[model samples]
Target: MADRDWSIETLHDDYRQALRIDAVHYDSNTDLQRIRVLENARFGRFMTLDGVVQTTEGDEFIYHEMMTHVPLLAHGHATRVLIIGGGDGGIAREVLRHPSVTHVTMVEIDAGVVEFCKEHLPSLSAGAFDDPRLNLVIADGAAFMRESDAEFDVIIVDSTDPIGPGEVLFTDTFYGHAQRRLRPGGILVTQNGVPFMQGDELTNTMRAFKALFGDATCYLSTIPTYAGGPMAMGWGTDGDARHVSLETLQTRYAASGLACRYYTPEVHKAAFALPGYVARLMP
Candidate 1:
């Protein structure tokens, strides 16, 4: 067996998680960020951007499923979808599974991340890049939201943490623009960081969401790679999707026939139940 080197994730200053790298699949500086695809024993192939773990082949289904399914299924009839910053195509892969979805406009800042992930971590995308319904746009996500006249039924912001290229996506201006691009009852979901470690991140997003939308809250999902308890998925909409009955969710889930690993009708409802500590952070 070849010798392994450990890749330490420097996401948290006080605590860090290290993954054993069996081999380096791809490592280079992309136009926007430093991207690395590493092979690991337990997590399989994983991708990191700027020394932070983005996704892995092993547990990608958990994050992708929750991020895409919760909002789409709750909305019950989301045909047009807008995805910002999901370069790995994992969110698109899950969104396309619903046959009701007609068009998917995926605006990614770095085309290199899409191309590299498609080659190195193909399973995460699982042929999503080749889908005809997907209209891939290479542009800044915040800029697209500001300038485009197009609207969507659901907008999923599959972004990185509030730093680097993704910093713009977390701003109040970006959230306001995203709300404007949504069709009347449209839902917006964002990748908020783990509340345990990044409490301020969730708080700032909630504050923005509350000011912009009628229903602003977050749901939780635990991904092993992400570390520090459960990660929060920000939810915002002026519509009643957040109040959709469990029976309604079950009907929608059954009709879609989605085979999800982490997201189910029951889990979807339970995810919205925030712990006291996390709820205190919300505006």
Candidate 2:
């Protein structure tokens, strides 16, 4: 009998993780990047873009919930939200959970990522695509931020690592444009990769954020599929949302009626407390 195929992710030069493939659900090259959907016993179904593990069914809730809920709940009232590069729809699914969010503009550079994920990884999105509040726009996220005069109370950057198509999203120019698109007191959260393995990524983004916003720091969440150590979610805003008291967060969490597996008021507060290594990386 032949050995099962393996999907190896080489995000780091010194380390790599391989998933023994139970099945090959989808594998093809989209115009923007190569997309692969593989099934594994441990992770269920996971999707990768350009050979990088984007999200997995086993622990996606951790990333999505933290990325979406922290900023929205901190802001206290975020009706209009913008999501840049979350084609897999995990972020959108989490964002729509907030009843106060009436509008969500999700811009993806690759339409193929959305279409394939809808077809292959339905569980990740649930029914976010059908949600009327979502305004799906197929365009470059950086360009959209620059061109659109529309303002958002919260903006979530659910991008892949700063490579290939996702590189531009981490630039200072893009961050500046996103800051301009934000309403006063609005929050911008970003996926800043795992700090232990990608220290430069965190440092570069924090430097850009520090220049762009009054409050610029990062929060941590551990996702197994992402490899390395704890991943950092970049937080930036002129508002005092990051300093929202624990009592306020608890009140908001209870009022939200959100049953989350990983994200709790306590976890939200603790996530922002950076370790010395991570703190040193911050500008």
Candidate 3:
């Protein structure tokens, strides 16, 4: 196999992680960002946006399953869901697994990423886009939530790191808007970066979450493609969601009958048990 290297510009440091690719299937400058799809022997087919690996066929289940299941299972009866910035459709695929989810409104800022992923990264989405319950909205996510009168049972911010187009989603004002758009007992989850390298990202999001929801916490998940220690995910809600019992989680897990590769009921309960270094990042 020939050597085709790809470099990722992570958020915290100047150094970039290089990936060895076997070949490039698609590489284009979209309206919003530069997107690339490559086949690798180790990682399989992977997609990157602006030099950041968004998802790979090999380990995508870890991030997608944990990010979607932890909050949904905790909420117990989330019938409606809102996803912001998951243009790759990995989050939507997981969210649709729950039979209780009747409607999913996905707000993505760029249509290019979605189209590209649908064409080149088909396994990542797994036909989730064609689901009848999905409502695809091509617009700015922050602005879309601010203008909409609808409320969701769960709101998930599956955003990129706090930079470029994804920077505004991490703002306090955007959090407030999301809070207002949620039902009284609704849960809100966000993708905070790796705490070891992006401590400020977790802390800053915790500050915003604290201001809006009294019960705000974070959970951890290990993803090999992320290239750091365990990744942190933001969890916030007004009710007793973060304190859900293991029995309740197990009950919900059994009721859903969703077989996941990375997210087990026990793992959902334990992901909240953060390490000392990561716990210190919590506000």
Q: Give every collision pair in model 1.
A: none
Q: What is the clash tally of candidate 1?
A: 0
lDDT for each residue of candidate 1 in 114-161, tens digit (9 for 90 to 100): 999888988988999899999999999999999999999999999999
Cα shift from native, residue 164, model 2 (Å): 0.8
The global C-alpha lDDT for each of the candidates, from Candidate 1 onward, is 0.95, 0.93, 0.89
Candidate 2 displacement at residue 178 in angstroms: 0.5
- For model 3, the local distance difference test gives 0.89
Question: Which model is ahead, 2 or 3, in terms of lDDT?
Answer: 2
Clashing pairs in 2: none
Q: List the residue pairs that clash in candidate 3.
A: none
**Best lDDT among the predictions, by candidate number:** 1
lDDT of 2 by residue, 86-111 (tens): 99999999999999899999999999
Please write out the lDDT profile of model 3 over residues 1-283, one tens digit for every residue: 2323654455446656667777799999977788989877899988888888888899999999998999899899999999998999999999999999999999999999999899988987889999999999999998997899999999999998888899999999999999999998999999998888788999999999999997998999999888779999999899898788999988889899898898988898889999999888887
Clashes of each: 0, 0, 0
- What TM-score does candidate 3 reach? 0.96
